[model samples]
Target: MKMLKEKIQKEGIVLSDTVLKVDTFLNHQIDPQLMQEIGKEFAARFKDAGITKIVTIESSGIAPALMTGLILDVPVIFARKRKSLTLSDNLLTATVYSFTKQESNDISVSKDMLHEEDVVLLIDDFLANGQALKGLNDLVKQSGAQVAGAGIVIEKGFQTGGKEIRANGLRVESLAIVESLVNGGVVFAEESVNK
Candidate 1:
């Protein structure tokens, strides 16, 4: 997590008071070594939860989720934003609005992949508005699977997402929590907490 924070500080771009772009290493171009470490951290955090499946939204969340699945020795299921022709008739769906993209997407997962007895861990590249994570959590609930927790690569702690999700009784583990993006500066929660 310290390495992740260092990466964010070095490479992340604070676009606005609310937007911190991490496309250099996370959103667009990925660092495999960092991702592997992230997977190890997530696996360690949720190892005792009896997780049977790792769930996440398609695109950005796939990398971290896949890595976690690999480390945990569990299958990863990603919710598709756009349904393909081969998708099954029975699908679990939810609407997730991206605060960064400023749009809503209907994410779906095949009902066959998740089971009632499975414990699911949700993973995502970022947790901003909590919509994506919530949507994935809904899909898991629809399948009658228990939610073990969520693993977020970066969380905008200045936003309501992390607080709301935690209030909803979901345990959230974020590698880097940006407390502020004020004046094009990234202030981490840990730094602020210590102050």
Candidate 2:
């Protein structure tokens, strides 16, 4: 986690008070070593959760989620943002609003992927407004699966997402929590704690 924090400090771009772009080493061009470490961290944190499956939304969430799944030796399932012809009509669907994209999309998961016996661990690159996680959780619920918890690579603590998800009784773990991105500066929650 310290290495991740350092990476953010060095390469992350502060776009605004509400936006911190980490595409250099995270979402866009990836650092495999860092992602492996992150996967290890999540596996350690959720080691005893009896996770039967790893769930995530498509795009940005896939990398970390795939890494986590590899570490956990569990199958990973990602929700598709757009319905495709290859996808069957028998699916669990949920509408999610992306605060960053300023739009909503209907995400879906095939019913065959999840089951009532599954204990799911949700993984993602970032947690902003919690909409994506909510939608994924809804899909899991529809499948009668139990949510083991969630592991997030970066959490915008200043936003309502993390808090709201926690309040909903989901065990959430984040590697780097940004307390603020005020005035183009990154302030981490751990830094405040260490102070």
TM-score, model 1 to reference: 0.96
- Per-residue accuracy of model 1 over 91-153 as CA lDDT, tens digit each: 999998876678989999999999999999999998888888899899899999999999999
Q: Which of the numbered candidates is closest to the native, going by highest lDDT?
A: 2
Residue 47 shift from truth in candidate 2, angstroms = 0.5
- Per-residue CA lDDT of model 2 for 1-195, tens digit only, reads 799999999999999999999999888999989988999999999999999999998888888888889989999999999899999998999999988889999999999999999999999899888988888888899999999899999999888888898889999899999999998888899644321
List ranges where model 2 is wrong by over 4 Å. 191-195
Provide C-alpha RMSD values for all models, in order. 1.9, 1.9
Q: How far in Å is the alpha carbon of 156 misplaced in model 2?
A: 0.4
Every model's TM-score? 0.96, 0.96
Can you tell me which runs of candidate 1 are displaced by over 4 Å?
Answer: 191-195
User: Model 2's lDDT to the true fold?
Assistant: 0.90
The positional error of residue 154 in candidate 1, measured at the CA in angstroms, is: 0.4
